[model samples]
Each structure stands twice: as structure tokens, then as C-alpha cells.
Target: MGGSPAHLDSPMVDGYGKLQTNGLRFHKRLTKNPCLLDCAQTKEYMLHVFRDCWRARTIWERLVDQDKWVGFSQGSSENWFLRNLEADFNSQGVTRWRLLFGVTVWQLLRRRIDRCFNTEVFGRDPVGVILDYVLEVELAFLNNKNLGRDST
Candidate 1:
């Protein structure tokens, strides 16, 4: 019950202004450009990078239900996270919806880093690949929990 906020901030655009150090004076020296996607120049906000960007959109479309996607993608980052953390029993029909949510966003950020800073490496469809990995981990965690409970 302690994960009130996750470090899902995007230092590139949204978090740039939140910095208070004297560094803020020369913050312009930092890279102030497109989002992690690099090509997505319109909005460099954290919301766009993690949820609304085309790259994130494709993955969320596959991972989230069409009925909830609209609301899920809307809201201040803090509210979006608070709701996800306090949400009911299951999201993707799994007991740990918040875990699934966290992992998906983490993977999205990792992917963004990979695509921008490192070499992109995924099979035919990268989105599908990431989705599969996230779901697989969710199931693995459930299985591990079941195994622990069974032995107890």
C-alpha cells in the first residue's frame, strides 16, 4: 500500500521545468528537442511520451480494453497513477492490475530508450513482443504466488 507514486516522469520535456538546481539556469544546455521518439515533435510532454504517443498508443491498444482505454489515457499523471494503483481486482483479467500497468509503462520507457539511445531489436512486431513479455511476467508472478501459497 506504499507505492503512492512511481518515477514515471519524462525528464526530457515535462520534468525539465521541475528542476530547481542552479543547473536550471543552464538547463537549456540540455537537449530540448523532440520526445523520446525523436520524430514526434508536436508534444514532448510526459503524458504524450508514455501514453498518447503513436508508439505508446499501439501498445496500449493491444494491452488495454477498448472500453477503458479512453479514460485510462486521460488524467494528470499523478491521478492516472493513483487510480491505477487503487483500481479494482483485475485489469487484464489478472489479480495484479497495477503491476501489469507498471510493467507496461516501464517497458514502454525502456523501448523508447532503446529506440532512441540504443539499437532497436525486436521480432517482426515490437509492440506485440513487448505485450507478450509483459503478459508473460504477469502470469509468471501469479504462478509463483500460487506456488508459495500452495506450499504454505
Candidate 2:
């Protein structure tokens, strides 16, 4: 939404399988539940982590609150993930949503790692930390684009 869509080559972007399953296994080995965030009620799978986890759900709801076109909880969680991936490229918010979606997944995955391997580094507020990181990266991206244009 902010810049011409550029290809993201990292596994974090193109490797849905890796992101989803790795977190599942990593957290599973740690807590016997695949969920990155422990809600203490039920075992978490990929969909729950991204869509139903109270923390993640709140983040997504806030992200799309003003947009009428999309709501994260409107339909099947699996369908939601698949549809967003294949959404019409020309749609107004699809690009932006895709970017945000990827960032959220990446951050969630990172949080999972920290929770398991570096407990001291995992913050008390994971959604907040993730949002801060995403915003910081977005700002850097915008600044780099501006510098490129100025140089050209």
C-alpha cells in the first residue's frame, strides 16, 4: 500500500509451511501445546495462534476496524488465510493487509522462539512488541524509499 509491491524472498514471507509448522513444533516441544501464546484452556494450532488467540485476535481486529471490506473473524479461519493469500491483486486493501498479515506471522514466530529459547527476552506484551517492530520496520522501508527517490 505504501510502495510498489516488491518481492519478499525470505522464508518468513514465502514459506508458509515453515512458519506454521515450525512454530507448532517448537512450542509443542516446550509446552505440549503448539500454541505460541498460552491461553491455558486448549491446545493451539496454527489458526488459533493467528486468528483465535485473544492476543492475536485483538491485534487483527484493531488493524481492520475501520475497513468494511475485511474482518479477520468473518469466516472460516483456514479459508481466511488461504483467501488472503490468493486475494485479487487489484483490491484496495489486499496489498496492505497481506503485508500486515505476513508481518504478524513473522513476529508471532519470533515471539515463539524467544519464549522457548530466550525466556528473558520475551516481553510481557507480545502483541505490543510485535506491533512496535512492524511499525519500526515500516518506517525504515518508507525512509529507504524516500532516499532512493531523492537519489534518482
Candidate 3:
């Protein structure tokens, strides 16, 4: 019953955390700005990075109804995933469709951060990002399955 949080272990978490942390540090070093350090340190926390951040809020709103995704507002990321994902997995099955949803969330978060921090882009296109990640994950799963079979 215990495993990493579905959304937390996603590629987006590692990629986004690295980008945010490094961007924070780079901003601090280049500008000699203490305010950048403050923003970076504050953003390192998960709730602030994922739930409360303005960019993340926009993505979350688009992908899920407020009532569905708002559990994270009350609890830790682990709690949110465990409670909600379990319900989703039960209903949807543990197939790629269910797992990819989690991956989509993670990827969208990373895309949102990239669009905001690395580019002049301001809009949050969560649906497009989610679709892209879902297709990528699905392709990876299929490739892995194909590789596992015998050549004969």
C-alpha cells in the first residue's frame, strides 16, 4: 500500500525542482539580489511550489475541477495523491490511462514553470501539456512492453 506519491515521483518533480532551485540560485548569484534568494528559498517548499504558486494554480484549475484538485490545499502532497489516486486507480484501473494522468500533472507543472521562467509566455496551457505527456508516457510503456517480449 506504500509507494512514492504518484505525482511527486513524476519526472516533472525532479525536472521542475532542479530548474526552480537552480534558477533561484542563478538569479541570486547574477543579480547579487537578496530578494531572489528569499523567493528561491520560499519556493523550495512543495506546497508553495505546486499548490500556492500562481502559475501552478492556473494549470491546476484547467486540468481538474477546483473541488477535485483542492485536496492538496488542505494536506501534504503525499496525502493528496494517496487519497485521490487510490480512488482514481480503483475506478480507472492501474492501466496507463490512470498512471499517465499523474505523469500529466507533473509534466504540466514543469511546462508551466518553463513557460513562465524561461520564456516571455504567460498563458497556462495545461491541457496541451497534459496531452503531450500522456502520449509520451503511453509510448514509453508500449516500447518497454515490446522490448520485454521474446524476438521469436
| C-alpha lDDT score of every prediction, in listed order | 0.61, 0.57, 0.53
**Tens-digit per-residue lDDT, 18-98, candidate 3:** 434434544556323323222435335555555556655565556554455544345776775565565442222224535
Tens-digit per-residue lDDT, 1-152, candidate 2: 56423433432333333343444455445345554445764455667666777766666655554444354455676787777665532222333556666777767656655555555664366556655666777788899999999998
User: CA lDDT of 55 in candidate 1?
Assistant: 78
Residue 107 deviation, candidate 1, in Å? 0.7
Candidate 2: 10-residue stretch with minimal lDDT:
8-17
Instruction: Please give, for residues 1-152, the per-residue lDDT of candidate 1 as tens digits.
Output: 75323442444223433322113323554434333344436435566667777877777776677777777777897787788787642335645667667777777666665564457575567555655776788788789999999998
Task: Name the TM-score of candidate 1.
Answer: 0.63
Residue pairs of candidate 1 with colliding backbone atoms: none
Clashing pairs in 3: none
TM for every model, in the order presented, reads 0.63, 0.54, 0.51
Deviation (Å) of 6 in candidate 2: 19
Score residue 6 of candidate 2 by CA lDDT.
42
Best by lDDT: 1
Error of 2 at 78 (Å): 4.6
